[model samples]
Target: MSLESFGEQLRRAREAKQMSLGEVADATRISLKFLQAIEAGKFSILPQAYIRAFIREYARAVDLDPEKTIQQYDMANQEIRATAEEWVSRSRNAALRQTKERTREIASLPVFSQRSVTIFAVLVVAAVAVVYLLNVGSDSSQQDDVSEIAFDKVIRESEAATVRTESGRALPTFEARDDSLRLEITTIDSVWLAITIDNTRRGEYLFAPQRKRTWVGKEQFQISIGNAGAASFKLNGVELGMLGNRGVVARNVLITRSGVQKTQQ
Candidate 1:
């Protein structure tokens, strides 16, 4: 059976059990995004081991035989692997043919004199050096921009910490809030995140390294991190640190005005 067919089977079983994706996520401790991906037959969303484990849990949640479901998944996955291998082999052969044709074309070209070749090489080196120096200058400018942004952020946060009310009374940042929660996320590496605000607004985000974002909620925030160590969290301007070790996925991390509640995956 195809992977999509297998996914449909799981979906049908879940429907028979009258289980929503969120219910399965709650029961299995899996991310709702992953559950959606599984039902769509997008096993490439996670590593094979995690996929297999999630599938097993999903199967059990819907009262399907875990081993049998896994066997079917394995058969589908094997078919996909075989297809990918065939495509790779074809690509390799095509690349080899192109390389050989290019080699023949190069052989048919007139050869340059040693002096001309040496002059051409020198010109190339000079061009490369100029490009390198330009890139270094650009990098230095970018670093300066980043440093300025960081400095501005520090100043803004410091000023925000003690804001004056309309009556000219200085109010503490936390005390001024009336049951509002703020979450600040900074990415150290490329990562995927699923965020829920006040249990009403939900969003999925993919962030590149050195990205910063903030979200506010009236009551709480729920977050799922695809690469836990790739992101640092701050709640109400207080650093919460990394979610877990590198390459680890963390799910059902709840945060409120009180504190962070972490669920180990």
Candidate 2:
């Protein structure tokens, strides 16, 4: 029931609901700084009278027990509402602490935003560089490329069935009434892999074809449809995974989320 323990419980509940601090703040219309202070057990950072009020709002936002949290805080800090002298002492201490913190922050402010921007830009550049390297290696004759490569071709057979959209056609893929996800691939010139799901990527299935197969993630999963090359794949009419060798038909891949796959008895 201590402040520290209450903070831990609050954090756990928030995380269990898959919420970020910013998400909570945005949903509750609360300030992020104050929310962080609450989570950090820096109750003195807020006005004393506002502490319980803030805690109540935060608990409601996160679906925690507000009254229980306040009771715990009171039990932990029994002298929380003592005489005027104690209140004065705590208030003065909190004010002095905030002043020192503000001074330190102002002194360090000049390069802070610049550093953050530089770091973010660097991360973006690094991501682009990695993708460029992958495409380059695929175009070249590199054997060690793990990044997926894609090649596109039209499917004359599927042209009659696919429902065309701006991005691509929506061809019927398998669906299980009991499961929330499904993946199915079919093709004539090459294999057409399809993965349609109600959830974001919870897993993947790897089918290493004999030739290099091109796999791509569009709405779900996609692969190249047509082409006589040793490697080709198709999903929803888009060409994605490509392989190199000439006379191969299929390959084994690691499928993620093992039990989700439907097996016919």
Q: Where is model 1 more than 4 Å wrong at Cα?
A: 25-37, 40-60, 63-75, 87-180, 208-210, 245-249, 262-264
RMSD to truth, every model: 12.4, 24.2
Highest-lDDT candidate: 1
Let me know the TM-score candidate 2 reaches against the reference structure.
Answer: 0.30
Query: Taking the tens digit of each residue's C-alpha lDDT, what string does model 1 give over 136-174?
Result: 544543331234445445434533443343365653323
Error of 2 at 121 (Å): 66
In angstroms, the error of model 1 at 156 is 27
lDDT per residue for candidate 2 within 37-87, as digits (tens), equals: 778776654333345655665677678887887787767555333433354
- Residue 73's lDDT within candidate 1 is 96
Superposed Cα deviation of residue 126, candidate 2 (Å)? 63
Tell me how far candidate 2 lies from the true structure as C-alpha RMSD in angstroms. Answer: 24.2
List the pairs of residues colliding in candidate 1.
none
